[model samples]
Target: MTQQKIRWLVVLMSLALIGLVIFQVVGVRETLNAKEDQFDGSVTEALDAVAHKLEKTEVAVLTSRRLAAERRKEKLQQIAIHDRPAKTEPKGRKASPRKADPATIQRYASHSPIVQQWEFYGRVTVPSDVLNRTNGTLTDAEMHYVEEYYRNESPPLNPDNRLRSELEKTYDETMFRNLRKDVESVKARRDSVGKFLANRVVGDRKAAPVRKHMPKEAAAKPKVTFSRPRVSRIDSARLPHRHMTEFEKAEQKSRVMREVLLDMFTNDRPLNQRVDMAILDSLLKNEMSIRGISIPFEYGLRSDDNPHDFIFTSSPGYREDRLLDGYSMQLFPSDLMATDNMLYVYFPERQSYLAQQVWTTLVSSVILILVMASCFYVAMSTIVRQKKLSDMKNDFINNMTHEFKTPVSTISLATQMLSDEAVAASPSMLNRYLGIIRDENQRLGSQVEKVLQAARFDRGEVRMMRDQVDLHELIETVVHSLSPQVEARNGVMHTNLGAKQSIVTGDEVHLTNLIFNLLDNAIKYSGEVTDVSVSTASSADGVRVTISDKGIGMTKENLRHIFEQFYRVPTGNVHDVKGFGLGLSYVKKIVEEHKGTIRVDSAPGKGSTFEVWLPF
Candidate 1:
């Protein structure tokens, strides 16, 4: 694609990504708001429930007290009756209680706690015994009811027949449970008093398991009859009241009592006294948990006029953060807008809780945005790099064409002159033309080799030699070869071999070429009198070879791409410096392959210095 097209594409893609990020952020914000709204609704519901629970609790307490007082009054009346003196009967007759009729006795027996329970439970066996007790007022046939009552009473083995109707059953079940609890309490007390060992011994002697052996004939015989196993008896009363038997009427009365309890349960005190901080805090925790909202909270009851004046506060934290806005509602809001107290509930981590509610969505959105951004970045970077490489390649082609064209033209011209009759007639002229051809051929071959060597290095095809190489000797050899070129240019070359250790492992040919390229660049880009300095010195775990030139140096910008392949410094309309711009680049590769480093120091108008450090 063209540069303009690539730039527009990048711009458009960037805008799209930004828009996508904005939409995702908005979506996450909306989700958080929704979660917060739900949380608020739940909190309000829980608070209302807590208020109702408090009211119900108060009603139950008052009702229990009222019931206890009535029971005490009944007990007082019973005590007075038992302590009262017997009435004077006929001024001299022995005082005697009136005997109750059979009908009255039966009526008393219907209540759960029957009249004279001990004597009633011990019903008289014979008529004479009842006659003696009643002062001969009852006859034998008339006392049939007493005998019939004993006969009709269900035994311990069969209680279902005696406790007829649901009401009686319900009361009987309750009494049975209480009796079991009382027995357990007695056993617990006996064990607590260190009577466990004594009880265990007495129990073993009194209730030891005994197995009676039966005769073989008896065991083989068929069963004659079936008898129910004996069962423990439960204390029960037969309620004769019609209201107790009529369930619907009884339920209606219970409802009326509940309404009275509810009215008494409501708190009527002033808001300040009504809201106990300790009780409110406990209620808040419990109700919030019931609603499944478990988070740290702060609550305070401030005045309606001045919010700063707190009637009650759950904690010091709530007081400190009172200025921060939270959920505010009226305490005792049951009175509508005229509520006296203003209650405020704050969540220190409200924002964090909202985030947690939508954590999965938030994290996924972030990851997707990052992934898209990274992909766009990689795509734009690749385009830029490819464009840069394309420009460099074009520059390289032009430089190569010019470099090759010069040598070929010279060789052609010399061959044409030698072919002429006058030029071939003299030996000097013939030799001159032949020399020109040979020199041009060598020049052309050298340029082709430079290109080929770079290509081989690019493909990693260049073979390496592991033998130790002497840097001092290698620098001298390269200098000797390039000395002729320096002399021709009216330049001077200096070598300062100062390193104690100069041997390194590398390819001999490539090392020679590496040195040749640096020296060549030093000579090519120089003033009228080229002054090149080649030196070797010992460095950290290596030998550093330095090549410097007192010539036109480069700018900082050019220095960046100085070692880049096919990259030449821009000099408008001037192709003064010639080559494929491959020398420095090739030098860098060779140095790196041998476990070495190369750095260059250069600036505009100042001299340049190339430092190559190869480990010994």
Candidate 2:
């Protein structure tokens, strides 16, 4: 395509690429936003689950404490008992049995017959063996003291009294110790459950392994069967006064147990305490993991009343004010089921996280842009190079046609003169015409030979017949041969063959042609009074030959491409110097074949220097 069209195409392509990039960037941004949103959603879900678990764990702990208290109460009740004081029999004959208290009978008369009968029967069937089986374990005085203490019919037992010791011996102080142990066990269970739930919240499988903690002996224990408590009915007349039926006693115990359970559920003390920092940290890490955020973080709790004070933090290095400097998330107390507190979590590597999420898209886009730019650059370079070569080729063809046409036209003119009868009659004129024809033929042959030689060198078909050659002798011969051309141009040629060791191994014919090409170029491009210099010098590794001319020198731009095939210095409408532009190219190829280096130095308004270094 034409240059204008190519430029337009490039512009259009660049605009299209820019548009595509913009569109893709927008799309990638949106996709990244969506991914970020998904991550945020996942984090929120994980945090919610942790909050729920924490709340549940707190409730469990309160319930365990309440249960422990109830157990202790039951143990205390089991160790103490109340009994009615025994009535004394009369000394006189057949003392009449004591009548039931009048107030007790009146109270029983207020209820239904069945209820009254039950109460009365319980009183009648009351155990009479109080302290009877433990005769050796406790003295009568100790027994009476214990019974009186439970019945509230005497002063309370003193820890220092002998009665207290006797009571402890009979009652087994181990029961109180057992009650303490049960409380401790309950506390341990609560702690273990709390830790387990915390571990679950953090996804720590190693924290509490179920199989590792379970005792093998537990599997060997026999299952115990449980039966419902049985209720008994009694006749009121057969029961003693101020007694409770078995059903009533069991009902009262059940009511106390229910109260304890209700208190357990209603307790809110656990929420007042500060949340466990380790558990909070674990929970944050778990949420981060679920959201695929692998970054270092710190967290702190802020109370609503004192927002500046952090009640708890993972580390002292954690700064609450700088929390918003990075990626931060907040959890309010309302969301966590705790006192008015806020949890703030900060991630230090927020940018890194974002980059990680979009690196693929960014890298791919950059690569694509670079590839496109590179392709465009290469294409433009190739086109420019091809255009330059085309122009040079046209110049070569025109110069070649002119060069050929000159010789052919001269030969034709000579032949036409020889064909004239008048010219044939004149012997000198005929001889002169014959000489002209021969010279033109020789010139034509030399041009054709030069072209053929260049082609052979290009195709690697010019085999060198290596032989010992004298460089000084070769330079002298070429200078002498070209001296006539220099004189014809009104120019002077100087040769300074200064090399002492000028003998080298090379093909003599090619070397001769190489020198001839250089000398010819120097003479051809010189001014009307051209002053050319040819010099030679010996070096440690090679021979150096230099050809210089005081002609219209070439610009630096032209010198750069001077030796390229078909390249010529621009001489604005001046066709005075004529050639196919092949002389320097051929010289360069022959010099290289002989393992030599060639270089040129020139500047506008100043002369040029062509230096050839050939190895010995």
Candidate 3:
């Protein structure tokens, strides 16, 4: 390729690489979001199902217990009266009438709301076993009361009053004896019902003994009744039913499976992890056509947020409000051969759609990310190959700077040795050699120190020895150290230490170094008319130390890299500023080590102010 084409290729390649990175980041983010959406949907479904099942179970348990209690009561009454003697009475009150009086039976039925329902199966007719046995016990007990009343029969002197008192006593004795029998009967009945209920509720039929005491015939096959009834609210009765296409049927089945699985997986998890209500509603509304049978059904959720426990139900009515609403179904009771009754399951549909919309957006985003990521990877490989040369150059420069530290240290040692009189012949020769060595050494030392400081700062090895120190004294000392440098460069140093002395806990040596570094940087980087300002005070958060200078000022680009090691501003038309770019880096490290924060406020062609905030 020609140089012009290669250069164009380089630019194109760079753009492509940037695009790829952006795509990858965006794609990953989208994928994660989509996964969360799907998970949430599945969880919502599961929680709804779990809650519904729990509620239904509780209802079932309670109902079973009630029935069991009734049965127990009946059994106990039978056992209590098994040995009672038979009773005979005058014609007006025969113990065993040929049949129970219709009026009396109606009156008894009226007293029991539950008993009226049994009329649907027809009036319960049998030999008067229950009443006859019960009455025999009552008659025997009443006779005993009557005898006692007669034995205690006595008159009060007042004729009318005596008659009333004797009658009251007789009535009281009869009631007392009858109440005793009734108490035993009721107790027996309650026990029987409780035992039956507990057994059935636990689904442990074996735990309860079979009702052997029930009359051989009454204990036989349970009788059931059924009648066909017109279903109300059939809007399309005359509309011809259509057969589902094969593909449509398969799709329906798939949807059902998905709904069922999602419901099972996320049931009763938590609100945040719930499934989309809209999807569940849609699934329920769609009629399933399987094996030429179209079974229309609705799935719903019922949350009974009983503080005692979390309960959810997924049966017809329960699912309506939570998932979908008002799903019409051609539902048949499971015991279809026997009971023929219909219950309309109503669901509130409004909230269902709201939950679903949120879920769809979340899931689709993830898919979008995956698609974008794939596209990004394809673009990345094509552009990444041609940038090898620039990459290598950057690496070489960094490494070269890193390795220059050894030679710089050796030169500094040699400069110190030459400056010593022991290594020189005369004072004049020593001074000349020392001057030469010092000049070269300081030059090398600045470069080496900058690189080493940058490296140490990056590796986090440079540590501060901290102690409680007065801000006033620390700043004064730093100002004194920078005074000589300021005068040598023909620059003036100014200071404004606040009136109240701020005592803070920090490393004095590092604080001093940090302050000196800022001053030195300002003087070196500034124009000939260098004006540096140093100030210390207590700010809102803590102690504030600011070093500001008016120099040639930095360009935005140069300012960006000012704190980078070996990143000297290119002095094309400007005077060379000595030293590697470790000044700010070292300052930044020192300030941070003292649990203080540093910030810079500057702009190109203006002054720069570096602020260090130390907590007191």
Candidate 4:
């Protein structure tokens, strides 16, 4: 391809590769981000789960304490009952119903308002809006009473007063319990009927007519039936901090009451006992494994108010500095006593773990990208080199055409001159034209042979005439033949035949051509006054031939491709030098056929040296 087309191709291919690389990079980046987000979500969920479990265990512990206390009291009561004596029964007589003792009734009536209300009206009726008037919080006096009741250090300040208050508390609790039961039954009825039969508001009553009403009989007692009452408003202060609404699913009031109960039972308990770090660790591990997170981790329970203050830790590494590095979750989130404790978990290898999720894809993509880059580079280089070779081949063909045309034209012109009768009569002129034709014919044959030899060697069709050749004698023969050209340029050819043995088994004809080509290149390319040297030395390899010239030497770039077919160094404005640019390539091939090697050394403005080594 031409340079322009090659350039466009390279640019287009480069853009494609760059775009693919960018696309891959972006995809990997997004994948990593997704993995990270998923990891964070899984970790947060696990942490919340562990915190929730800790809260459950704390609640269970508080409930167990209350049960143990009640059990102990019941066991003592059972022992007392067992020790007491049983009353004897009268034979064949059913026990009569026991009447209340008048003194016991008098004592209770003196202390309890419930007893007084029953005595006066013969029915205890609590106000409908009584619940709205009382806030759920206990007063200072009530709190002291509760504390004293639980401690039981001594007799209460007023035992009867306490007993009367307890009775009133029990009566209010029973009334509310019965009311809740009645409301539940009414809800079921409403669901079945889809609506209440009686309206929420009480209706006006009509006077009973004498015709429809029945006369009162002896010992007849009438009972009045009341409609369902309207729901009274509750005290806002007694309600949970967050109001319950239609949109709210969880019962905030119930959850708050549970927290309150838990705090009341466990407020005096040890703070560390509220959560077990060991159990918390187990819960975290199980949750994380469910999400495919199998890695070492550290966890800590730190105070929410002051994170530096740790309540407990699975490991010391989970500290204040690393608190931000981990997932944080509130422990016993609704527990009033354990509200300050927060859970924190950190993993040292979290980044590595996330990277490993796409490790196979990442590694494979990078390797493929490198291989593609390498292959692209090699292909581009091969294409460009082939283009250069095509250019060089064209140059060689043009040079050979000119070289052959000059010789053939001269030969044709000389023969034409010999055909002149007058020139033939002049012996000297006739002899000159004949010699000219003969020399031109020899030139044409030599050029044709050089081309044929190079082509045959390239096709591996040139068979070597294997024979022992003496390099010392071969060098001398080539030098003698080119001595006249060296003289014409006022140049000298030096020889150093220092080798004791210079015999090598090789094709005599090809070896002679190899030596002749090297010597001829030295003479032609050397400066006006050619300075050439030919030397052969005895070495471990049998023979070493060196041909060097103090000539217009080549640059490093030219020396690199000097042995490539159809490659020639640029010699500007010096048209006298001419060749098919295949001399060195043929020479190198000939040396290789004989199991030898050739090398050159040259730099700009410096002389050039060509070295040839052959084995015996």
Report the number of the highest-TM-score candidate: 4
- Tens-place lDDT digits, model 1, residues 441-548: 998998899899889988989878778888778888889989899999999999999999988888888899899999998998886669999998997798889999
Error of 4 at 43 (Å): 1.1
Candidate 1 regions with alpha-carbon error over 4 angstroms: 73-267, 270-283, 290-292, 301-312, 316-324, 329-343, 527-529
Give the number of the best model, judged by lDDT: 4
Task: Give lDDT per model, in order.
Answer: 0.70, 0.66, 0.52, 0.71
Q: Estimate the TM-score of every prediction.
A: 0.68, 0.66, 0.38, 0.71
TM-score of predicted structure 3: 0.38
Query: Residue by residue across 1-616, what tens digits does model 2's lDDT show?
Result: 5778778877887887788778778877886887678766765676676666565665565556656776556544433211122233223323122223334334334533333322221222111221213222334456456556756974556654554345334333333333333322321122312232111111112222222322455444454443432123323334333333333444444445444434433333432263566676787788778667676777676666576677766678677676644333334333423445556666567557766788898788778877877887888778777878898889988988899999999999999989999999999999999999999999999989978887887788999999999999888888888888878877788889899889888999989988888888777778666899999999998899999998778887787787888888787897988888788888888898899999998776677789999998
- Give the RMSD in angstroms, all C-alphas superposed, for model 3: 26.5
Q: Where does candidate 4 have its weakest 10-residue lDDT segment?
A: 201-210
- Please give, for residues 252-357, the per-residue lDDT of candidate 4 as tens digits: 3233334446354435554466667677777888999988899998777766555567777776544565755778887666643455667778898988998999
lDDT tens readout by residue for model 3, 1-616: 3457656766676676667667756765575666546544543444344444443443454445555665455444443343233332323442332333344444445654334322222212122322223233224445457556855894435874554445444544543344433333321111323232221111111222323244555445354433432223323434234343332343344334333333333233432123344444444343222112132333533232322222223452343243333422221122113221111233243234333535565456556656655665554544443343344345436545554554566567767777676767577766766676666667566566656767777787876666888878877887787788788878898899873658887778777767778888888767777789888787666788888888766677766656654455565644355454556767767777777888777776687888888888
Off by over 4 Å in 3: 1-426, 435-450, 555-561, 573-575
Residue 135 CA error for candidate 3 (Å)?
A: 82
Cα error of candidate 3 at position 331, Å: 26
Worst 10 residues of 3 by lDDT: 197-206
Sort by TM-score, top down from the best: 4, 1, 2, 3
lDDT of 4 at 311: 70
Q: What is the C-alpha RMSD of each candidate to the true structure, in Å?
A: 17.2, 16.6, 26.5, 14.7
Q: If both were scored by lDDT, which would come out higher, candidate 1 or candidate 4?
A: 4
| TM-score result, candidate 4 | 0.71
